[model samples]
Target: MKIGHYTYQPGARGGIASYVRRLGNAQADIGHDVEYLCRNGEGSDLPSVREVNGDVDLFETAQQRRLDVLHLHRRIRHLPEHRVPTVRTMHGNQGSCPSGSRFLKRSGRPCNRDYSVSGCLWGHLIDHCGSRRPGNVVNNFRRIETEHELAAKIPTATVSRFVKERMIRSGCMPDHLKVIHSPAPDLNRPPAPLQHKDPPRMLFAGRIEPKKGVEWLLRSLPKTDVPVFLDVAGTGDIAYMQKVKALVEDLGLTGRITFHGWVEEADVYRLIEQARAVVVPSLWHEPAGLVTLEAAAVGRPVIASQVGGISEYARDPFALQVSPGDVDELAECIDRLALDPERAASMGQQARAIARDRFSMDDFVSNIMDLYRSTVTTANGLMRR
Candidate 1:
């Protein structure tokens, strides 16, 4: 089968890029020809990238490639006349909410105010959905429209049921939308044995954005009685970054919290290896908990916000969950896990077991291939008719 993966970004900067790389490799390993259609970025040397920057590149150049399945990792402009079968993997909440966080900035919480012209406008004007700028609101409406168009036009897959439900609530057709959990990392290269730390260090490894709730985590530190250190390892907006640093300094947590900025995937795992627990304090309904899954693969328990898909995973015997933006609860969790290494180790074991059993790359590839084949067969049938 000739399969091509498409996204706006060319490089491995975020979780979706990791998804593309992992799935592309698996498809190629099975002898199915694989290609990635994206605009080349400055920092990456990824292969099979057809460096075009806009809809023209995808509509004209991507169509010329004549792929059996053009799997999109995000929403893009596609005229109704375009014929190639496409499947979109909803990696985030951008398609459903203007903020992409589904978080109401006015109230400072996750919102379910459905995607509507008035609702979106009100969100921007009152809630600060994405930005307060009217221009950004106009663009967000257009993006939502594109999401609806693509959702109605082609097959759609989401990384989590939580995200799928959000899209459906925003008027995406429920008939074709499906949930296929993201793949776990290659765990076959010999497992990293579990080793607990003495003082305990919690790791937060993602963009320090509005939705990430890093500031909330920082605030929680003042209440925690434990001597544990927090190693924050990702970068984002400069102003927010400064605010975080200032907050850290104000709390006199300058000695306890270290900003490692952006680190490589190898370094992430290495840090995970030495850490006591990983924290995913996302204030938004995270489309999927890829980092949590990654930590699970490394035999580390995550203390994630009990919102979005993390709640779904937290329903089981893995990952400590706290209410989003709850500083006291989070502080307690830190104190509990940091002080008692045995329970943390036990949860880590459950995490490793869950990652291996439920989130395997083999299962991920099989489900995606099945969808691709079905989409191809449907396209062929239409042509024959």
Candidate 2:
């Protein structure tokens, strides 16, 4: 099958771009003709990946290439309306929530209300759900409306059941939505050895944002009897980063935590393998936690928030779940993992097994291929009719 993957950038940076690269390459490896379509970038070393020049239209490119399927990872204006069979993967709550984060600031709980001017605006100003910028607020609502329109027309795939439910609440047709869990990265190695050193070490990697619950993690540190050293990697939201840094000082956790800011993907995995455990303390309802999947792939036990689709993977012997924003519970989980070296190592082994057996790349690609074929067949039937 000829497949064209579309995203905002050609170079892999964040989760969507990384997934696009991984999917395209994996499909290519299995003998499918794959190409990447992007707005603009230096493009990558991958020869199949190409940049859509300013003059070239995105839809026209798909037509000229005669692509059998166009899988969209990012929201583009007219890509879904093309003659090509298109499948849009809803990676987050962008279509349903104006803030793109279904989190209520004051209460620190996931918001279920569909997008609206009055309610979301109140959320921004009063509840502190998202940005307070007047222009940004208006633009976000318009973006959500556009997203809803596209979702209604095309086959929309969500990363998890939580995301699918949110999309349904936001008015996407039930038949239009499909839940496909994000694929686990294949580390292709046994779980990293547990270095049971003094002051047990933990790692937190991903974009540093308020919704990420970095503050909650920091707060939990003081309560832990085990003085676990946390190494935070990845960067986002300068203002929020500053707030977290300040809180580190305020909580007297300056000596215990080190902010690595941003690091390459390889570096992240390296850090993950070195640490005794990984922490994903997201306050928001994560559609599916990629970080949790990565930690599992590395064969490290995870201490993750129990909210949203994270529970789907970060469960049983793989991870110790704690309620979102509960510092005491989080700290307790950390101490349990830290103090018991044998249990932590055992959990790491189970996590690796989970990654290999349940969320393999081959299974992920096969399921996607099935969805693509079905979409193409449906489109062909409509054309014939």
Model 1, residue 118: what's the lDDT? 84
Clashes of 1: 0
Write the residue-wise lDDT of candidate 1 on 76-100 in tens digits: 7655465577787888887688667
Q: Give the best candidate by TM-score.
A: 1
lDDT value for model 2: 0.84
Worst 10 residues of 1 by lDDT: 189-198
Instruction: Give the per-residue lDDT digits (tens) of candidate 2, residues 273-324.
Output: 8788899999888888898889889888999998777888787888998989
For every candidate in turn, the CA RMSD to the true structure comes to 1.8, 2.1
Give the lDDT of residue 143 in candidate 2.
82
